[model samples]
Structure formats: C-alpha cells, structure tokens
Target chain A: MENYIPVLLLLGFAIIVASSILVLSWWLGPKKPLAVKLSAYECGVNAEGSPHAPFASKFYLVAVMFLLVDVEAAFFFPWALVYKESLQLGPILFVALVIYVAIFALGLFYIIKKDCLRLR
Target chain B: MNTVDIAILVAKTLLFYLIVLHVVPIMVWVERRGAALIQDRPGPNRVGPFGLLQPVADFVKFIFKEDPIPTGANRGLFLVAPALILIPASLTLAVLPFGDKVKLFGREILLQVADLDIAILYVLAIGSLGIYGILFGGWASGNKFSLMGALRASSQVISYEIPLGLAAVGAVAVYGTFSLREIALAQDGLWFGWLPRWGIFLQPVGFWLFFIASFAETNRLPFDLPETEAELVAGYHTEYGSMKFGMFMMAEYMNLTTISGVMVTLFFGGWHLPFVADAMLLKWIGSQNLLGLVQVVIFLTKVAIFLCVFVWVRWTVPRFRFDQLMRITWGRLIPLGIVNLLVTAGVMLWLGGWK
Candidate 1:
C-alpha cells in the first residue's frame, strides 16, 4: 500500500493542474449569453425535442456483454502473474488455464451467434 | 518517509506533470503539420519556424474565446467532465518508469514517480475511466449529436478494452509480474546472442494486438467514430467551447502519450537501448546519473517514434464505418487475443517456462 502513496500524490497534482486550467479559462473567457448562441448546436436550424430519447437496445446489450468479458479478463491478470511459475511446477495450471479460456470462448461464441455486436 | 524523500517525491511528480502537459501541445503541432505534409501543403509555417509556436497561439485563442453553457444542458456535469478526463490522463504518468534509478543527493532515486506493485492494473483501471469524460460531456450537453457520440464512444471503448486487457495479460504471463518495471527489466540482454530479448520477440501477436487496440483506446483516426466530424459535428464536445473543449483535446493527446509510454515499457525495451546492456552503457558513461539521463533520452526517442506513427496513420487512413469498427474488435481482435494468449502460454511451457 505504501507504493500507492505516490499515485495518490500524482492524482492530487493532476487535480490541481486540471482545475486551475479550467478556472483560468473560465476567468479569462468572454461570457456573452445571447439566446441563440446559448442554444445547442444543430448545424444551423434549431434543435427539436429532448436529446434524452431512448437509444437502441443493442447498446445496452453491448454494455452487458462488456461486463461479462471484462470480469473474465480481470481474472486473467492474477492468473497471468503466476502462470510462468505454475507451468514450471507442472502442467496442471496450464491445463486449468486452457479450460478456463475454453469456457469463456464458449460464451464469446454465444455472443457472436446472437449477433449482439452488429451495429445494424 | 523523511523530509528528503518527500521532496524527491514532489519533484518527480511535478516533472512528470510537466512532461504530460508539454506533450499535448507538441502532439497538436505534430498532428497539424504532419497532416499538411501528407496533403502536400505547407502547414502553419506562419507561426514560428515550421509552426512550432502554433500550439501556444492556439492556447491563447482558447482562453479568450467565448464559453457558453448550452441553454438546456446539465450545468454541473458539463463543467466537471473535462477535468475528469484530464486527471486520469495525467495520473497515468505515475507508474511509467522513464529511466533506471539515478544516484542523487547521496541517495538512490527511481526515475518513476510511483513504482507500484500493481502498475499494469493501475494503468488499465485509470485508462478505462477516461471514457466517462466523453460520456458525461456528451450527455450533459443535451445535444442529439453529442448524445449519439457519447453512446458510440462508451460502447466502443468498452468493447476494445477486452482485447487491450488480454494483450496486457499476455505480457504479464511472459514476464510473470504485474509491475511494469519488472517487465521492462526482463526484456534486457539478447536471444541466441543476436536478437534483443524484447517483449515483441516473445509475444509478436500480442504486440500487434496491443498496437491496434491502443489506437482505438485513444480514439484516433479509423477508430474516431465518436468525434467523426462528417456526421456528429465534432461529436461529444460539440457543445463545449473555449478551454473546456481544449481540456478534452489535451486529454486525448495525453492519453496517446501515456499509451505510447506503456507500449514502450511493455513491448519495446523501456529504457534499454537495443542490444546494449545497461552495465556496458554504465561502464561507458561512467556516472550513474548520466547513464540515467541517457536512458531517459532513449525512452523518449522510442515514444516519439510511436507518436509519429500515430500521426502518420491518422492522415493516411480513412475513418472506419461504425459497424466495421465494432466488427473488427469483436469479430476479429478479441478472438485473436484469446488465441494469442493461449498459444503464448503453451509455447512458454514448451520452452521450459520462459527462462
């Protein structure tokens, strides 16, 4: 955890730098608030309706798929760290890795078969 | 930590902060000038020699320009979004080891700002958070184009992130550690007394996968569907003006630099010159501090080359269609990454566990 101190300090420095720039820009920038200028850009014509309309369910499907795969990928990190040592010991760990990946590959194939990735 | 340790820490943090800050404008200049070169025109020669000062001029313009909050926009998220993006981009520098340790003030000081045990994990976690800036910026703007852009950007980032993580996993398995410094150190020396023992040689497929995924992660051309000017009208930041938009631009370039740094650390021998051992260089240089400085220059040179490749690709390739972008990551890259990981593990075992 001591290793994380510099990371925290770096984050603090970044926050200070980023916020200061935003403040500088806000302070120096002109603020002319004509109704036309303040309105959302729509090329030229006025924007109609709320921008919060429902989007395609495919996007939600993609998010769900991402969660599943990302968690699996996260698991690989710890396994990856120990993999070389485990292989040196025996083939058990290597076989286990293959099985784990095989199961995940099955899930990936299912995702592909369902066509969740198709943007059409 | 003692007072001296604290001071050293503060100095390293500031140094890295300045490096990331400087890289943004330099990248902006390179992008414009490189684009012009490819298009057969003189690019921004009016501002300083070869438009070197164009970024400075651009910064001044951004500060004085009119900044307006769109009438129906979410006031709070709109303001917080840019800083959210910039912070992560800058923070990633903490784990990147610029050079070997230098002896200074009668102490051995590591060149990295933070040498975490979980450095690779830290990078991956911070990198994923950057998408929120684009998502919030787009959603808060309450413009149709911005919303569409945010949706596209979020999904795209999340999808490509799988292949990116898998590629990193391949590196970790080969090096057998999550710390980036160890990975870089492991790449030292030679293979068969001829080739440099870089990660590229051990995991060639992983390198290519990582290289391609990084382009998508940074949202550069070909994968820049989120901010495609033709359709989305500047996409996520369409409603932002002045320095808020500037922050987003800075964040993009900073992310590019960070990704490039990570690539060099992981795949290309971090601070190690190709085929030249550190001890040999140390003998020639005859000073630890001087050797450290030379290593830093070497690391930066590698990163600069990668940055040039990024700029070159941006101008050379046309943008990918949204469906095609999604298809490539999902249909092609992810499967390839998995196969690559398995094959690497199998080969490592066959070669008697990556000595």
Candidate 2:
C-alpha cells in the first residue's frame, strides 16, 4: 500500500515514545525495594480473601452494559450529519435512525429498569 | 500509472507522520512548562536545554525499560489493543488537507492523500473505531482499574459525539458539502467586505459544540478521567508496560493533533487567512514556486498554533470531576448543540441554504 510508509512511521513513533518514557523513569528512579514494596496492592487493607475471589456478577454485567451504550452514543454524530443527504430515501433514513435511537433508548430503559447502574 | 507520483505521495505521508510525532516531544515540553506558568511553579527545567530533550530522554527510558506483562492477561488482545487504537488514530490523517498543493518533479502533488468523497464519513468511522482499542486495552489488561478507565473513556467519547455532529449541521446546511476543503473555500472572502472568516460568523454554536466535543473525544484533561491518575491509578494502561504502554500515550497526543487539525479545518478557516486571497497572492509570489511554499507554511503554522492552544488549555484548566464532565456533555453541550441545529436548520431553510 502507498499508505504503508505513513502507517509504519506512526507505529514506529508510538513505539519510540512509549519506550522512552519508561526507560527514563527506570534510570532516574530508585530501584531499592523489598517483598513488601512489590506485594499485591491491598489499599493498606489486609487481604480478606483470595485476590481472585468472585466479584458480584452484577458489577461485571453493569460495566459491560455501560461500555456498550457509551459506544453507541458516539455513532449518532455521522448518522445525524448524513441523514439529510438521504433525502430521496428520507423516510427510510428517518426510520433507520429512529430504529437505532429506539434500540439505544430501549437499552437505556432496560439498564434503568433493571437498576443496574444504581450504586446503592 | 506513474511511479514518481506514487512515491511522492508515500514520501509526503511518511514525512507528515514522522513530523507529527516529533511534535509531541515539543508538546509534552510545552504542557509541562506551560502548566507551571499557569499554576505558578517551575516545570521541567533540570534536563537538557530547559528540558528540550526530556522527551528524548523519555524515549530512551521506555526503550530500555522492563516490560512486565500481567500474568493472566490475554497476550494477543493485549498486544492487538494498542495497535488497534494506534492504527485508526494514524489512518484518519489520510483525508486531512494539511496545506495548499505544491509541485514535485514537475508533477503536481496534493498535500492530502486521496480526497475521497466520503472523507468526512471516513474520519467519523475511523474515530469511532478508536474506542475499541481503549475498550479492549482495558478489558484485556485484566486490571480492574484499566477496565474502568477504558469504560469511562469509551462512555465519555460516545456521549460527546452526538452534540459534536449535531452542531455541524449548520455548516453542512450552508455549504451543502461535507468536504473540509470545500468548507474552507466557502469562507474565503469577508462578510459584506469586513468580517474575517465564515464558520464562526455563521455557526458559533456549532464551533463550541465541536470544540468541546473535540476535547472529550481526544480524552484530554477534563475528559481525561479515563487515564486520570488520582481516580483510576493510570486508567486503562494501569497494567500496560514498555512499548505497549508507549503506543497508548503516543496515540493520545496524535489524537490531540488530529482533533485540533479537524477543529481548525472545520471552524477556523483552515489554512485561510483574512484578506489573503490566493489569486491576489499568486500574482505577487508567482503562481508556481513561492506561493505554494508560503501557503504550506501558513497552514502548518496555523495548525501548530492550535495544537499549542490545546496544550495551553490542558495546563490551564483543572481536570473536571467525573460527574462535572458528564454534566457538561449531556446536560449543557448536547442540548445546546441540538438547539443550535434546530435554529440553523430553520434559518438556513428560510434563507434557501439547501438550494
């Protein structure tokens, strides 16, 4: 691809920058530490159970749902801008947008109805 | 059909990508120093030449640093996630018209890559894909903090995209075109012979929405909760190490440049200055050599200044509380964008904008 040069350059630059940040930190920072310094982070609270103790399924479920909808929010931009361009098929475009919105709203409704986001 | 033309295109693109990345070292330096000035403290001055080479030092550091992979992390997805984000972030530069066209080896070479008719759509689609990298990076890292940061970033960007797009309707309505070059050209002359440029005059609301959303999309200071250290302990990259983590940081700055470029192109009469008509300038500078170079310089200078503004603001503002960030986007920005759209549409329809 003619575009390969730019693509490669971008990736290489990313690698270079990332590598530099860490390398510098290591050079300047003190390396002295003990088993306690690198122990599993426990927020200064004693480990009550195994680190892999099962979290509430609801936490994972709600988090996944949150991510899904947040992404769907981003899709609205292009669709809104181009909706008018489909004037010949304006009705179809309108319905499609409506369907997308409905799906989004329904998902929101489901999340709320299920009380998934409520921290309490 | 021609080898030289293809080579020129690739060469220019490669140059542009490298140059854009090189800018980060400067941007990072600027942010550090500027934030100090803004907050009233000394920034990074201990390193080479007022920390000019701090980024270079950082570059060496990351290269030699220990890359510790989390034991249970999904190795493939973890590696792929950063690339996923980096690829789209880089690829979106394709449609941007960075400068006026110039000559290379007697054949004309445009400053942009192929000017696809769906350039605007391509930008949106690719930008949308950028979220996946963040999502998967968090998900694959097997760190709760990373996952939460990714979730926050993902949600923040998505929420902001709506108002951002809605605000652009006025411009689309007026210009009846989606292409950035066309939009820039439409604003060439003064409003009734005195005003400076076009989009700002017509759709200030759209400009605000776009700018606000632009910050959120790039995951900057206020919208940067995704990586906010205090709340999430490095957010999505909490577990990322070595070059894998480097890619994420580089991509964020690249996005800063990209969004700033888009904002300049969309709102600020990109590459166009007040009273500097190209035809009139062509007469003085000669149609061929000097004018093209000047135009390119002017365009880059404009984009660079905006990028600096991005750094300036990042250092100036306190990062918004997560609730505050969400409130601004959904409560204020979205409603304002929608209202702006409605008003613009009504006014444009009245003025025969679609005509």
Report i-RMS for every model.
1.0, 6.0
True contacts kept of 1: 0.85
DockQ top scorer: 1
Q: DockQ for every model, please.
A: 0.85, 0.16
Off by over 4 Å in 1: none
Q: How much is A23 displaced in model 1, in angstroms? A: 1.0
Each model's TM-score, in the order given? 0.99, 0.80
lDDT of 2 at A99: 69
Of the candidates shown, which would achieve the greatest lDDT relative to the real structure? 1
lDDT of 2 by residue, A38-75 (tens): 33333555434443344445445545764675577556
Per-residue lDDT of B262 in model 1: 95
- Evaluated at residue A61, the lDDT of candidate 2 is 54
Q: How far is B247's C-alpha from truth in model 1 (Å)?
A: 0.4
Residue B76 of model 2, lDDT score: 77
lDDT of 1 by residue, B235-340 (tens): 9999999989999999999999999999999999999999898989999999999999998899989999999999999999999988898889988999999999
Model 1 Cα lDDT, one tens digit per residue, A26-75? 89987778999999999899888888889988788889989998888889
